[model samples]
Structure formats: C-alpha cells, structure tokens
Target: MSKEAIVARIEKKPLSMTINGKKIGPIDVPVGMPMIDFLHHYLNLTGTHFGCGEGVCHACTVVEVKSDGSMVDTRTCIANAHSFDGKTIITIEGQAKTDASGNVTQLTPIQTAFIEKFSFQCGYCTSGFIAGATAFIDRLKREPVKRADLETAIEEALNDHICRCTGYVRYYEAVRDVALATPGCVIGQEDKR
Candidate 1:
C-alpha cells in the first residue's frame, strides 16, 4: 500500500486491557498507533523505553499473556495498539511483586539482579531487560533448562535484547545467577547464584 493510503487508514477506538493487575481503559486511542505511544501518552506508564522506534531493538519489550496463560515478550514499537485489545500486558511496572495486602513488597529477581550486578548504565534498556528476563525465568520454571544446555538456553533467551551501555556481561551474569539460584528450574545446577 502507498504511504498516503496507510496514513489515511489510521483509526481511533476505545482501548481496554489489564495492566499490572488493574483494569485500564475503554479509553479512546488511535487504532494504528504504536503500543509504546499508548503506554507513554495514554496510560502515562513511561517505563517502557523507546529505543530504535523500529522493532530491531527490544527496548520496548512487554510481556503478553497468552490465552493459555503462557507469557512471551513482544516489541511494541512496530505493533498497533488495537491488536492488543483483549490481551493482558505486563510492563516493567507489573514485574514487581505485590504483598497480600495489595502493597508492593519486593522487586522481582530480575530487577534485584540488575541492581546487584550493575547491569544497566543509562537505564533506558533496563525495563525491556526486566521484561525479557522475567519471561526467561518464567519459561525456565515451566520447562526446566538442562544443565548441559544452560549457556545456550540463556543466550537464546536474551539474544533478542540490545543494551547500549554497561557492557553485556553483567546482564548475562545476572540472568545466569538468577537461574542458578532457582531450584528445579536449572537442571543439575550448581550454586553459582
């Protein structure tokens, strides 16, 4: 389609979805608008970063809860907000654990690891990393990683992310540490955590 044709098709509609455990919207938004824009401008949840504005960088990663209750990381920059209407989204803000009394208690393991390992520099990519890491750790919990394939598993999980600063080693180390610390997740694991 021509640029003008695509531009002419930009639409507006009410958006409704579950964000962080809260019900949001039935709010109006442009149909073709990027999910990142809706997140920042409409919802005022700005933690999801805007990096390349293209899908090349995973800085805008958000966890999409599938119908089967499985989760995966998705890029928002290249996706239309309307496509997420019925889906449950977990952004960086949702990654934190909440207490029984509805108060937020502690950060998720990935967030804690990031701080401990000093994995981020400017922190623009930290949100995305958290999302990806959460998904990775969750996946391991569901389908445990074999010890023999531990390194490859971690690499495959995080390879999609792009971090501009603080060197990649720290981020990888943090993930490995978290994985090793979790029991029954990493098969035949040593206590590297």
Candidate 2:
C-alpha cells in the first residue's frame, strides 16, 4: 500500500520561548522545523545532540517541564519548535547549578555520578542519558521502586539510549549508585544482606 499523502504546508512564523531560563526569539522560524536544528543553530545548544534523525536512537532526548513542574523526556527530532511554544525545557546546558555570578557552582548528582563512574565514551549520548536519568530519578521521588526491582527500573529508564562507547554496565551502575547513595530517594524493603 502506498503511504504517500500530501499535507498542506503551514506558514513559518517567529518563535519565542524561555530556554534554560533565558528569553529567546521573536526571531523568525518556520513551522515544522526540527527542534534539534533550532537548538543547535538558533540557540547554540549543541548538547541536545542529533544522532539519528529518527527518535529510535534516543540520543536527542530533552526534558520537557510541564506547567505543574513535572518533567518528561521528549525526542526533539520528532518534535517541532511549535510543540514547545509555551513550554519550559531543560537541556544539558542547564544541568548544573549556577552561583551568584552565573558561574557553574555544582553539577547535578547524575552528572557527578557519570563522571565518577566514567559512564561515557565519545559522549554523544551523555546528554540523553543525563536527561533520562533526571526523569527517572524524579519519578522515583513520586513513586519509589523496590530494592530488588531497582536494576530493572534503571534498565527500563536507560535501555533505549544507544551508546557506541560504553556497553551500558557503567551507566547502569552510575544511576543505581546515585539512587542508593542519595538516602531515602527510592523506597523499598530493607536489604537482607
């Protein structure tokens, strides 16, 4: 069966949104433009990445902050700029805490764990991993996972992302370590060991 169908092209217009807490746009942007391009070319946020144009690779994942302050991972490659018209997003650039003068004060614990565990190789997938980990950890706060199920939970969170360098064990260990070390973050039965 032929799957070709013609859809009317939407007119391009200016796009403006708050990115990493900064106002951007009122600048011209076309409708249907991939957000990865906008972030890289328009905003110079190369950290969001562009591994596969398709969302399957998971390397271009970004966190979308909802109106209620909850977050979810979104694939920028499959999403358009207008999809984020009134939304807040956290990219790799915004992962660290800033000091009074705007200098980076500290890295998020996940990033720190990655550094401690050496969780990346070429680092193309680091941003995606970090974004996913952030989402996962945030979820644990609301709905904690069992101790025995911790590995599975971490796997489910990060298994989709493709890493050409690391075989993923290190990444898994890093996320798990953070969860375990964070103190009362993930709810579970007491360890019997």
Candidate 3:
C-alpha cells in the first residue's frame, strides 16, 4: 500500500496505446513518468498546453475514459505514464483536424465557436477550454438548454483555466455563443445596455 513498494513491484513494465488516433505506450518508458513529457516529447501532441504543472490551472486537461465507461478530465502534467494503459483519450491536437468531406470534421462545434467568437486573448488557455467545453457541450446536446442556462453552463465548464490577459469575458462570451449557435441549444441575443 506504499508508493515505493507499489512502484518497485511494477518497475520494468511499459505502456502503449492509440492517442488522437496515433499509437503510444506499449513501449518502454520510465516508471512514474509524467504524461505531459511523453505527450510533448515523444508523441508530439503539443496542442495539449501546460499552464500549471500542479493541476490547478486545468490548462493540460484532457479527456480520457475510465474503466467504468465514464469520461473524465485528467491533468497530463502530473498523471503517471502507466495510468493510461488501455483508455481512449482526446486532446487538443485531436480536435484540430478536419475531414475530407468538407464538413469541418474533428474540430468540434464548440472549438469552431471559440474561433468564430475570438474567445481568447493570449490564447494559452484556449486549447484547454476548447477540449473541456466541447465535451461539456456534447453532453448538453443530449438535453435542452436555454439562453440563461447556457451562460451558467459555460461558466461552469471554464471554472479552471486562468487568463491574465483580461480575455475572460470574451472567452465566456464565445462559449455561450457557441452553445446558443449550436442547433437546439441557443442562448438568446445579449441585451445591449
């Protein structure tokens, strides 16, 4: 039940799998290696930005599936390399591609919405927000959301990423706009004061 004991028990194992459609893990890597290092150094998925390595900034947030079939956010900066044994993950790079059908493929509606609305200032947090919010919006699509409800949802979705460039308003606006613009989940036009 101790960290040293557990690590010593599995010191010689490696992990590998498909990430954003590319194969990773199943290869030899050091025990307790951080996922961020593997992503940025080995596989080159730079879209997963890192703001704070302590997991408080949420900038490195990526979606991965748990064994229970539940999707959750994990901080790549501190996540152990071997923890990703057999799970599917979606990172910022995964959302940047499009399809040959000319339908704006991999970039989710929420990401497109962020671009259309200029939802970022320094742009450091956009990737995290995009990945996090798109997943949130996808779930919202399964239900009904109104204008006010949309604002609350966007606010809740981006409660982590810190923006010192004073672009928070625009970021929130962009997400709300995307949710509303999305068919069947629209927030009414903002009231001009």
- Of the candidates shown, which would achieve the greatest TM-score relative to the real structure? 1
Error of 2 at 122 (Å): 1.1
What 10-residue stretch in candidate 3 is worst by lDDT? 184-193
User: What stretches of model 1 exceed 4 Å from their correct place?
Assistant: 1-10, 98-104
What TM-score would candidate 2 get against the native? 0.87
Better by lDDT, candidate 3 or 1: 1
Q: How far is candidate 2 from the true structure (C-alpha RMSD, Å)?
A: 5.6
Clashes in model 2: which pairs?
Answer: none
Question: Runs in model 3 with CA error above 4 Å?
Answer: 1-12, 65-71, 98-106, 184-193
Per-candidate alpha-carbon RMSD to the true structure: 4.3, 5.6, 5.6
lDDT of each: 0.86, 0.85, 0.72
Writing each residue's lDDT as its tens digit, candidate 2 over 1-193 gives 3333222344677887777887777777778899898899888899998988999878999887788787788889988987788678999998898977879899999999999989898899999999999888877877788888888999998889999886599889889988877676567656432
At residue 179, candidate 2 shows an lDDT of 85
Q: How do the candidates rank by TM-score, highest first?
A: 1, 2, 3
Looking at model 1, the pairs that clash are 11-31
The global Cα lDDT (0 to 1) of model 1 is 0.86
lDDT of 3 at 189: 41
**Candidate 2 lDDT (Cα, whole model)?**
0.85
